[model samples]
Target: MKAELDLARAFALEEDGVTAIEYGLLAGLIAISIIAGATAIGGGLNQFFTGVGNWFSGITVP
Candidate 1:
Protein backbone atom coordinates (compact mmCIF):
# COMPACT_ATOMS: atom_id res chain seq x y z
CA MET A 1 0.00 0.00 0.00
CA LYS A 2 2.88 2.37 0.77
CA ALA A 3 4.56 1.70 -2.55
CA GLU A 4 1.30 2.24 -4.43
CA LEU A 5 0.78 5.57 -2.68
CA ASP A 6 4.32 6.69 -3.50
CA LEU A 7 3.82 5.67 -7.13
CA ALA A 8 0.63 7.68 -7.35
CA ARG A 9 2.31 10.69 -5.79
CA ALA A 10 5.19 10.50 -8.24
CA PHE A 11 2.83 10.36 -11.20
CA ALA A 12 0.87 13.34 -9.95
CA LEU A 13 3.99 15.51 -9.54
CA GLU A 14 5.52 14.60 -12.92
CA GLU A 15 5.78 17.35 -15.54
CA ASP A 16 6.98 15.37 -18.57
CA GLY A 17 3.47 14.51 -19.73
CA VAL A 18 2.38 18.14 -19.64
CA THR A 19 5.56 19.25 -21.39
CA ALA A 20 5.03 16.73 -24.18
CA ILE A 21 1.50 17.96 -24.75
CA GLU A 22 2.68 21.57 -24.98
CA TYR A 23 5.36 20.62 -27.50
CA GLY A 24 2.83 18.71 -29.57
CA LEU A 25 0.53 21.74 -29.71
CA LEU A 26 3.42 24.04 -30.69
CA ALA A 27 4.52 21.67 -33.45
CA GLY A 28 0.96 21.48 -34.78
CA LEU A 29 0.75 25.26 -34.96
CA ILE A 30 4.08 25.50 -36.78
CA ALA A 31 2.96 22.87 -39.30
CA ILE A 32 -0.31 24.72 -39.96
CA SER A 33 1.51 28.01 -40.62
CA ILE A 34 3.91 26.33 -43.03
CA ILE A 35 1.06 24.71 -44.94
CA ALA A 36 -0.84 28.00 -45.24
CA GLY A 37 2.23 29.94 -46.45
CA ALA A 38 3.07 27.25 -48.98
CA THR A 39 -0.47 27.23 -50.37
CA ALA A 40 -0.47 31.00 -50.88
CA ILE A 41 2.95 30.96 -52.54
CA GLY A 42 1.99 28.06 -54.79
CA GLY A 43 -1.09 29.93 -56.07
CA GLY A 44 0.88 33.06 -56.81
CA LEU A 45 3.58 31.07 -58.67
CA ASN A 46 0.98 29.27 -60.74
CA GLN A 47 -0.63 32.54 -61.80
CA PHE A 48 2.74 34.10 -62.65
CA PHE A 49 3.78 31.11 -64.78
CA THR A 50 0.45 31.01 -66.58
CA GLY A 51 0.80 34.66 -67.48
CA VAL A 52 4.33 34.11 -68.76
CA GLY A 53 3.18 31.16 -70.87
CA ASN A 54 0.33 33.14 -72.33
CA TRP A 55 2.65 35.98 -73.25
CA PHE A 56 5.06 33.55 -74.94
CA SER A 57 2.26 31.98 -76.92
CA GLY A 58 1.21 35.35 -78.27
CA ILE A 59 4.58 35.92 -79.96
CA THR A 60 5.19 35.23 -83.68
CA VAL A 61 8.45 33.38 -84.50
CA PRO A 62 8.86 34.94 -87.98
Candidate 2:
Protein backbone atom coordinates (compact mmCIF):
# COMPACT_ATOMS: atom_id res chain seq x y z
CA MET A 1 0.00 0.00 0.00
CA LYS A 2 2.84 2.37 0.75
CA ALA A 3 4.42 1.72 -2.66
CA GLU A 4 1.12 2.36 -4.36
CA LEU A 5 0.76 5.67 -2.57
CA ASP A 6 4.28 6.65 -3.63
CA LEU A 7 3.48 5.76 -7.24
CA ALA A 8 0.33 7.85 -7.10
CA ARG A 9 2.23 10.81 -5.76
CA ALA A 10 4.77 10.52 -8.52
CA PHE A 11 2.07 10.45 -11.12
CA ALA A 12 0.50 13.55 -9.69
CA LEU A 13 3.76 15.47 -10.01
CA GLU A 14 4.40 14.46 -13.64
CA GLU A 15 5.13 17.59 -15.65
CA ASP A 16 4.90 16.38 -19.25
CA GLY A 17 1.16 16.92 -19.69
CA VAL A 18 1.20 20.33 -18.07
CA THR A 19 4.16 21.49 -20.21
CA ALA A 20 2.51 20.39 -23.45
CA ILE A 21 -0.76 22.14 -22.59
CA GLU A 22 1.03 25.37 -21.73
CA TYR A 23 2.99 25.34 -24.99
CA GLY A 24 -0.16 24.62 -27.00
CA LEU A 25 -2.01 27.53 -25.42
CA LEU A 26 0.93 29.86 -26.05
CA ALA A 27 1.07 28.87 -29.71
CA GLY A 28 -2.66 29.42 -30.15
CA LEU A 29 -2.52 32.88 -28.60
CA ILE A 30 0.44 33.89 -30.77
CA ALA A 31 -1.38 32.83 -33.91
CA ILE A 32 -4.51 34.78 -32.92
CA SER A 33 -2.53 37.95 -32.14
CA ILE A 34 -0.69 37.82 -35.48
CA ILE A 35 -3.93 37.45 -37.45
CA ALA A 36 -5.57 40.28 -35.53
CA GLY A 37 -2.58 42.60 -36.12
CA ALA A 38 -2.47 41.88 -39.86
CA THR A 39 -6.18 42.56 -40.30
CA ALA A 40 -5.90 45.88 -38.45
CA ILE A 41 -3.04 47.06 -40.68
CA GLY A 42 -4.17 45.58 -43.99
CA GLY A 43 -7.43 47.55 -44.34
CA GLY A 44 -5.88 50.97 -43.89
CA LEU A 45 -2.86 50.27 -46.10
CA ASN A 46 -5.05 48.89 -48.86
CA GLN A 47 -7.12 52.08 -49.05
CA PHE A 48 -4.06 54.36 -48.92
CA PHE A 49 -2.45 52.61 -51.87
CA THR A 50 -5.66 52.54 -53.83
CA GLY A 51 -6.05 56.32 -53.53
CA VAL A 52 -2.43 56.93 -54.45
CA GLY A 53 -2.75 54.83 -57.59
CA ASN A 54 -5.89 56.65 -58.61
CA TRP A 55 -4.25 60.05 -58.15
CA PHE A 56 -1.52 59.11 -60.67
CA SER A 57 -3.96 57.64 -63.22
CA GLY A 58 -4.43 61.00 -65.03
CA ILE A 59 -8.19 60.45 -65.39
CA THR A 60 -9.32 63.61 -63.62
CA VAL A 61 -12.37 65.47 -65.01
CA PRO A 62 -12.59 69.30 -64.82
Candidate 3:
Protein backbone atom coordinates (compact mmCIF):
# COMPACT_ATOMS: atom_id res chain seq x y z
CA MET A 1 0.00 0.00 0.00
CA LYS A 2 2.82 2.43 0.83
CA ALA A 3 4.63 1.72 -2.44
CA GLU A 4 1.49 2.36 -4.43
CA LEU A 5 0.89 5.65 -2.64
CA ASP A 6 4.45 6.75 -3.26
CA LEU A 7 4.20 5.89 -6.95
CA ALA A 8 1.01 7.87 -7.31
CA ARG A 9 2.58 10.89 -5.62
CA ALA A 10 5.59 10.76 -7.92
CA PHE A 11 3.44 10.49 -10.99
CA ALA A 12 1.40 13.47 -9.94
CA LEU A 13 4.52 15.61 -9.52
CA GLU A 14 6.18 14.66 -12.84
CA GLU A 15 6.60 17.48 -15.40
CA ASP A 16 8.32 15.65 -18.27
CA GLY A 17 5.15 15.36 -20.32
CA VAL A 18 4.32 19.04 -19.92
CA THR A 19 7.87 20.07 -20.84
CA ALA A 20 7.80 17.91 -23.98
CA ILE A 21 4.51 19.43 -25.07
CA GLU A 22 5.86 22.97 -24.62
CA TYR A 23 8.93 22.18 -26.68
CA GLY A 24 6.82 20.69 -29.41
CA LEU A 25 4.68 23.81 -29.56
CA LEU A 26 7.78 26.01 -29.77
CA ALA A 27 9.21 23.96 -32.64
CA GLY A 28 5.94 24.12 -34.54
CA LEU A 29 5.78 27.91 -34.25
CA ILE A 30 9.36 28.27 -35.47
CA ALA A 31 8.66 26.07 -38.46
CA ILE A 32 5.56 28.09 -39.35
CA SER A 33 7.47 31.38 -39.19
CA ILE A 34 10.24 30.04 -41.39
CA ILE A 35 7.76 28.82 -43.98
CA ALA A 36 5.94 32.13 -44.06
CA GLY A 37 9.16 34.11 -44.43
CA ALA A 38 10.41 31.87 -47.21
CA THR A 39 7.14 32.15 -49.13
CA ALA A 40 7.15 35.95 -48.99
CA ILE A 41 10.77 36.16 -50.10
CA GLY A 42 10.21 33.68 -52.91
CA GLY A 43 7.30 35.74 -54.29
CA GLY A 44 9.35 38.93 -54.28
CA LEU A 45 12.27 37.24 -56.01
CA ASN A 46 10.02 35.76 -58.71
CA GLN A 47 8.59 39.17 -59.56
CA PHE A 48 12.01 40.78 -59.70
CA PHE A 49 13.36 38.07 -62.00
CA THR A 50 10.34 38.32 -64.28
CA GLY A 51 10.80 42.05 -64.65
CA VAL A 52 14.49 41.58 -65.49
CA GLY A 53 13.62 39.04 -68.15
CA ASN A 54 11.16 41.44 -69.74
CA TRP A 55 13.73 44.21 -69.83
CA PHE A 56 16.31 41.92 -71.49
CA SER A 57 13.79 40.75 -74.09
CA GLY A 58 13.13 44.36 -75.15
CA ILE A 59 16.82 44.89 -76.03
CA THR A 60 17.75 44.78 -79.74
CA VAL A 61 21.25 44.70 -81.27
CA PRO A 62 22.11 45.91 -84.78
Candidate 4:
Protein backbone atom coordinates (compact mmCIF):
# COMPACT_ATOMS: atom_id res chain seq x y z
CA MET A 1 0.00 0.00 0.00
CA LYS A 2 2.80 2.41 0.80
CA ALA A 3 4.54 1.72 -2.49
CA GLU A 4 1.32 2.22 -4.39
CA LEU A 5 0.77 5.54 -2.63
CA ASP A 6 4.30 6.63 -3.48
CA LEU A 7 3.82 5.73 -7.13
CA ALA A 8 0.62 7.73 -7.23
CA ARG A 9 2.40 10.71 -5.74
CA ALA A 10 5.19 10.44 -8.29
CA PHE A 11 2.70 10.37 -11.11
CA ALA A 12 0.90 13.38 -9.75
CA LEU A 13 4.11 15.40 -9.52
CA GLU A 14 5.40 14.51 -12.96
CA GLU A 15 5.28 17.35 -15.51
CA ASP A 16 6.67 15.68 -18.63
CA GLY A 17 3.26 15.34 -20.30
CA VAL A 18 2.37 18.95 -19.58
CA THR A 19 5.70 20.17 -20.91
CA ALA A 20 5.31 18.15 -24.08
CA ILE A 21 1.83 19.56 -24.62
CA GLU A 22 3.10 23.11 -24.16
CA TYR A 23 5.88 22.51 -26.68
CA GLY A 24 3.43 21.04 -29.14
CA LEU A 25 1.21 24.10 -28.85
CA LEU A 26 4.20 26.39 -29.31
CA ALA A 27 5.30 24.53 -32.43
CA GLY A 28 1.80 24.63 -33.84
CA LEU A 29 1.60 28.39 -33.32
CA ILE A 30 4.97 28.90 -34.97
CA ALA A 31 3.92 26.78 -37.93
CA ILE A 32 0.68 28.76 -38.31
CA SER A 33 2.58 32.07 -38.28
CA ILE A 34 5.03 30.81 -40.87
CA ILE A 35 2.23 29.64 -43.14
CA ALA A 36 0.39 32.94 -42.87
CA GLY A 37 3.52 34.95 -43.60
CA ALA A 38 4.38 32.78 -46.57
CA THR A 39 0.87 33.09 -47.96
CA ALA A 40 0.95 36.89 -47.75
CA ILE A 41 4.37 37.09 -49.33
CA GLY A 42 3.37 34.68 -52.07
CA GLY A 43 0.34 36.78 -53.00
CA GLY A 44 2.43 39.91 -53.23
CA LEU A 45 5.07 38.21 -55.31
CA ASN A 46 2.46 36.79 -57.65
CA GLN A 47 0.96 40.20 -58.24
CA PHE A 48 4.35 41.77 -58.85
CA PHE A 49 5.33 39.05 -61.29
CA THR A 50 2.05 39.29 -63.11
CA GLY A 51 2.49 42.99 -63.54
CA VAL A 52 5.99 42.49 -64.84
CA GLY A 53 4.80 39.87 -67.32
CA ASN A 54 2.03 42.14 -68.52
CA TRP A 55 4.50 44.97 -69.04
CA PHE A 56 6.82 42.71 -70.99
CA SER A 57 3.98 41.45 -73.16
CA GLY A 58 3.11 45.03 -74.10
CA ILE A 59 6.55 45.57 -75.63
CA THR A 60 6.74 45.35 -79.44
CA VAL A 61 9.91 43.73 -80.76
CA PRO A 62 11.07 43.85 -84.41
Q: Which lDDT values do the candidates have, in the order given?
A: 0.99, 0.96, 1.00, 1.00
TM-score of 3: 0.86
RMSD, each candidate, Å? Answer: 1.6, 2.9, 1.2, 1.0
The deviation in Å at residue 29 for candidate 1 is 0.7
Backbone atom clashes (below 3 Å) for every candidate: 0, 0, 0, 0
For 1-62, candidate 2 gives per-residue lDDT tens digits of: 99999999999999999999999999999999999999999999999999999888967777
Model 4, span 7-38: residue lDDT tens: 99999999999999999999999999999999
Q: By TM-score, how accurate is candidate 2?
A: 0.83
lDDT for position 58 in model 3: 100
Better of 2 and 3 by lDDT: 3
Residue 48 in model 3: shift from native, Å?
A: 0.6
Give per-residue CA lDDT, model 3, range 1-62, as digits (tens). Answer: 99999999999999999999999999999999999999999999999999999999999998
- Stretches of model 3 off by over 4 angstroms after superposition: none
**Residue 44, candidate 3: how far off, in angstroms?**
0.7
Q: Pairs clashing in candidate 1?
A: none
Q: Which pairs in model 2 have colliding backbones?
A: none
